[model samples]
Target chain A: MTNLLKNLATTEVLGINRRNQDYLRPLNSPSAKKIADSKLLTKRILRRSNIQTPELFKVIRTEKQLKYVDWSSLPKSFVIKPNQGSRGRGILIVYGKKKGSEQAWIQSNNQIVRIKDFESHIMQIFEGRFSLGSRRDIALIEERLKTDKLLKKYSYKGVPDIRIIVYNSIPLMAMTRLPTKESNGKANLHAGAICVGIDIGSGITINGIHLKSKSLLSDTYEPIEMTYDQKINLPIKGIEIPNWDEILEIAVKCQRESGLGYAGVDIAIDRDKGPMVFELNARPGLGIQVTNNAGLRFRLERVAGIKVKNTKHAVRIAKNLFGGSVSEEIELLSGRQIANLVEKITLFEKGKYKVKRKRKKLKQGTLLVKGLLDTGLLTSRIDRDTAAKLGFIDAIKSFNSYEIPKVFNSFEEAQAYIDKMDNTISKHEDIVRLAKITEEGKIRVRPVISVNLLIKGIHKNIEVIISTRKELIYPILIGRRELKDFLIDASKTFTR
Target chain B: MILPNLPHGIIVLLLFLPVIATIANFARYVLGIRTLGIYPALSLAFAFLLTGFRYGMIITTLVFAISSLSYSLIKYTRMHYVSKITVIYTANAIFLILAFTLFTQAPFFSNVLNLDFNEINPAGVLLIAVLIDFFVKQTVKKDWFTATRSFIETIIVSSIGFLIIRIPRFDLILVKYAWIIPLLIIVNVIIGQGSNLKLLEILRFKQIIVKPNPQDDKSS
Candidate 1:
C-alpha cells in the first residue's frame, strides 16, 4: 500500500513552500539590492527620507580617528555593528547601567558582560572580523528601541520586528518574527526565533502562537484538511495595523528611491515610536511561503504584468486579489474529502472467468460455491464455510498431505478444508508464513491466508498475505503494489 | 570509538584553522597587540604550548624577521592586491627554505628550527603566509601606528580563535553538532541589526571633533 501511494500520489499539495527561491529570483528589485548590499548608503538614504532609524553618531574614515575617540562617551544601552555585515554577524548589543566609575555591565543571555569584555568585543568588531568580504568597516553605536507590550509575551528578550514583502509598491505579505529562549533572545528564525505570518488586511497574525501545546480549534487551523499540525493560529483576528497606510507609502517611496521592483521592508514598532523603518532587504527569505503556506509563484505571476500607478492602488489590488484567498486555496487542496479509499489485498491463483447457473430449481436452500471470485480483492481467496457447503471437504483432508499441520478447530477445520482444495486445484502457492492467528468476532476461522497471485491485467506475479475478517466494507484487501496499471478515480463510484 | 569520521574531522580542522587565523587577524587589527599575522600568532601560541613560550617567541621572531625582509624587498615593485598577497606568500615559502639552510649550516638556530620541513604541512605554511600577508598589507596601506594597531587586533582575534580551537570541550561539541553554523548565522544577523556604531568611528570621533583646524577656521 505504501508503494502504491508513493507511485500514485501527486505532490501538488506540497508545492507551496517558503524556500521557493526560483520563483522570487526574477522579481529581484534594485531597491532591495541596494539596501542589503550597502549599509552606509541605506543609512544615508533612510535619514534623508525622514525615516527614523538608529542614529549614526559618527564615522571613522581613517586611522587618525581610531587614535582620538574617547571610548567613555559611548552610551550604556547602545548597539555596535558593521556596515557591510550580512546576516547578524559583527553586532554587539550593550545593555544595563554603569555600576562603578570605570566598569559598565552588559546584558547578554541574562549574564553581565563587564566593561573590559565589552571593549575587547568592540575592538574585534573594529578589526573587520565580522565584516562582509573581510573588508574594513566602521562600527556605530545607536540607541536600542524598547519593545511594545503586544509582542512582549511572544519575544524572549530581543526586539520583535515585522517583515513586509513589497513588490511593485504593493505590500504582498507580512510576518512578525519573534525571539525565543532557544534563539537566545534574538528575533531571527535562523537564531532560534519563530516566524508568524500576518494577515495584511487585518493586523492579526494569520499563523502565530505562543510556543505552547494545545488542541487547536478547527476554524483557526490553516490548510484546513492537512492532517499535520505545525503552525500556530494567531488570536487577534482583525485589528488594523497602526500605520498601515504610512507603511504602504514608505514601501512605495523606498521602491522608487532604491529603484528595486521587489523588496522587503523591515519595520520595528517601538513602544515610544509608532513604526520605525529598520532596514531594507533585497533578498528576502522564501520561508515566508511556509509562514503563509502559499506559493509566491502564483502571486508574482498575477502582479508581474500589472501597471501599478500608486501605493494606495497597489495596496487595494493586493488586498482585493490575494488577501486571504491563498489560505482558502491551501485549505481546499489539503481537505480530507478528496483523499482515496482503498484496501489491501493478496492474490493466490490465476484463472479464466467461468459462469455456472443452477440447472434445476429446487426447494430454497443456501447453495454455496467452492470457487468464489473476490473481485474486490487483488488476489483470489476462498471462504471456508462456503467451500465446505459446496462439497469440497476433501480439500481439508489434503492439507496434511502437503505437510501442513491441521491446527484449526471445528469452524476453522471446515474453512481450511475448502482453502486447501482451492489451492491444489488453482495451483496457488502458499508463501505467507503464519505470524499470528486469532478469532476476531463470532466467526471461528483461520483469519490469515498466504497466497501467490498473478494479476489479470498486469504480467507481474506477487506473493501476499490476507485477512478475511473484513467482510462488510470490502470482501478482499488489495494492497497498493498490485494496483500499478489501473488509475482509481476516487471521486467516482465503484463500477464493479 | 566515538570519534568523528575522518572526512568530517578534516573539514572541522580546515574550518577551525581559518577561523583561528581570522580571529587572530581581527584581534591584532583592533586591539593593538603585536603578533605574527593571524596564522603565526595562533601557531606561535600553539607552538608555545608544545615548546616553552621563550623558545616559541624566539622561533616566531626569527621567522617573522626573515619573512618580513623578504616581503619588503618583494614590495619594491608595485603589484595588484592579489599579486601582492601572492608575493608575500612566496616570500614565506622562501623563508621556510632559508630555515632549512640555517638548520643544516648554523647549529645556533637549529634548536629553534627543529620542526620537520619534509612533512610539508600546508596548514602551518598557510598560517605563516596569512600572517605575512596581513603584516605586509597593513604596512603598505597605512602608517606604522595604524599597522601596529591592526597588528594588536589580529593578535586578540587570533588568540580567541586559537583558544576556541584548542579547547577540547568546544572542539567535541562543534564536531558532534554542526547545527551551530545556523546558530552562528542567526547571531550574525542579530548583531548586524542591533549595531549602529562603527568601532573605528568611535576610536576617531574625539580627535575629529575636539581640535578645530586652521583651514576650517579660515573657511568659517
Candidate 2:
C-alpha cells in the first residue's frame, strides 16, 4: 500500500485541485485565456498570422439570425461548433445529406437528422446549451476534415487528432486521440477515445492509457495488470506517426502565437492538406500526464523561465530533453532492446524431416532466411513456397478445411453450415483478411496461418500471413507484432 | 469567548467577519480569483451600515482610484513586480494620510469636499484600505492590460454587489432575517456550479455570430 502511494506520488499525475492551485492560476493570463475560451476570437487571431484552420462557412448569433438560416444551402458535410464549447461538446458533425432529401442529413452516428431538428439544434446552440456556463453562444459552421488514409483503420467514425501540450513555446508532450466504438465518433479522452502517447522526437507511439483507469497499455497491446482490475489492451503503440516534424512545429508556433505560456494545441492531419490547428486550450486537462505515463509538472518545471528564441529552437530543445527517453522506457517495458530496420535470421526447424534444398552442405531442414522488418504489417508474412519447403503444407490444409462464407453466400446458409460443423471446426473459424497493395499497385489479401517458427534462436508463436513472393527478393518479412523480442539492423545482412 | 456584556453593534460586526470571509473564500474557490473584487464592494455596503455611509464611500473611492492610477506608473518601472507593488502600497498609504489630514484640517480642502471628519470610523477606514490594497496586489500581478481589465471587472462586480446590499427595504429585511444568509449560500453554490464559462468569452464571441440568411431576416 505504501509502495502504491509512493508510485502514485512519483507518477506526477496532476489532480484538478492541484492544477488549479499550481498550473492554471499561475501561468494562464486572463486576456489570453479569454481568447482560448472563445473559438471565434481564437480563429481570428490565428487566421491573422496566416495559420491554416478549418474554413468557416457561417455563424448564427441571434434568434432572428438563426431563424433566417437556410438549412438547405449548407454543405452536405460540415461541422457546427459552438464558439465557447468545452471538451467536445456543442459540435454537430453532419456526415452527409441523406439521399434525395434536402431536409434530411446523416449525423456521425448515421442518424437521419431532419431539417426541423437541425434548426432546433442551431437554436439550442444560440441559447448556449453546449457552451461553457450554458451561456448563449454562436454556432460556427466550418469544413469537416477528411481522415488521413493511414489513420482510418484506427478510428471508428470520427477523424483522429493529435493533442500536444506546449509549454513556454516548446512542444513538451503529445497524444494521438483515436475515436473508439464506445466514444461514439468523438475524439474526447473522457468520452472513451484511446490516447496514445507519442515520443516528442521520433513521433513513434510509446504508451497508451484508458483515461478512466489511468492504466498503462503495454507494448504487446495489453494493459499492464493493476490491483483493482485489468483492461483489454488495444494495439496502439510503436507505429510511427506521419508528418511528425510538421505537427511539432505547429504546436510550438500555436503556443507562441496564442500568447499562452502553457497551452494545448489540438491538431488534425487532413489527407491532402496536412496538419491543421483546430482548437487551443489555455487550461489543457491533466489527462495527458496519465496517457504519457510522465508527470507534466516535471516537464513544465524543466522549461520554466528558459528563454525560447523561436518555435524552431523550442522544438529542438524539447526533442533534446523529452525525446529518446520513451524509447529506453519502451525497451524496459517490452523486454526487447532496440533493433535496426534490417536483421539476419537463421531459419531452422527443430529436427530435419527431409532435405529439399539445392545446397546440401549441412543438415537438411536448415536455411538462412534474410528478414526485413516491416512495422506497417501486423503479422509476419512469408512466401508460400518457403512454407511448402518448411513442411507447413499440412497445417495449411487444416487451416483451409474450416468453412468460410463466400461473398455472395447467404447468412442463414453460413450459420447453418457452421452449426452442422463440430466444435473444433467452429473454434478455429475466425477469419482475418489483411489487404496490402503490391509494388505493381495490385491489392491482394493474403492467406494467413498461426504457426510456430524459429527466428534468431527464439521459438515464437506467430501468425504468419502467406503471400506468393514470386517477384519479391526476400522470402520472409518480420512484422512489428513478432519483433517484440528482436531488434533488426538493415546494414547487417545475416546476423544472429 | 462570548462576552454577553458587549454592545450589539460590535457583536454583529464580529459575527459578520467570519461570514464575509467564508463568502470571499467561496468566490475564490468556485468562480476563480478574478471575482474577489465583489467582496470589497459588498464590504462597503456593510461598512455603510456599521460606520455610516460617508466614511465607507470615501474609503472605497480612495482605494479604487489609487489602485487604478498606480498602473500607469508601474508599467515604466524596471523593478521586480513585488518591489514595485510594495512601492505603490507605501505611496497609497502616504496619500491616504495626506488626504485625510487635508480633508479634516485644511479650510480650502474641507470646503471643497464638504465632509464631517467626526462621523468617519477609524476601524472602517483601516478595513477599506487593507481590502483595497489586497485587491490591487491580486490584480497587478498579471500583465498591465489583463491587470487593468480585471481591475475594472473587480470594480464593476463590487458596485453591483454594493447596489444589491444598499436596497433600502432589502437592507432592512436582510438585517431582520439572517436566515436569508443560508439561502444566499445555496444560491451561490448553484451559481458556482453553473458559471463554468468566463463572462468575457460570452461577450467577445458575439462579434462572430453573424446572420446567415439576409432574405429570411428581411422578410421577418
Which fraction of the native contacts appears in each prediction? Answer: 0.00, 0.00
Off by over 4 Å in 2: A4-18, A211-234, A333-496, B1-220
Which RMSD values do the candidates have, in order?
Answer: 24.8, 21.8
Per-residue lDDT of model 2, residues B85-116, tens digit only: 67777778888888788788988757776776
lDDT of 1 by residue, A1-496 (tens): 3432342232111121211233334455444565656667777787787777766655554456655656577666766666766556656676765576445556656567665554444555555655555566666666677787666645666787788877767777777777766667666655556667666644555554332211111011222211112244333333335566666667666655665566777787777876777677776755565565444444655566778887677776666555643333334565411112332222323231222224333222323122222234444333444333333334433333564333445556656665655445334233232222333544332323333332322233443333334453443334444554444434323121
Pairs of residues at least 3 apart in sequence or in different chains that clash in candidate 2? A339-A487, A339-A488, A340-A488, A342-A489, A342-A490
Q: List the global CA lDDT of all models.
A: 0.51, 0.64
* Per-residue accuracy of model 2 over A97-126 as CA lDDT, tens digit each: 889987888998788888666666677677
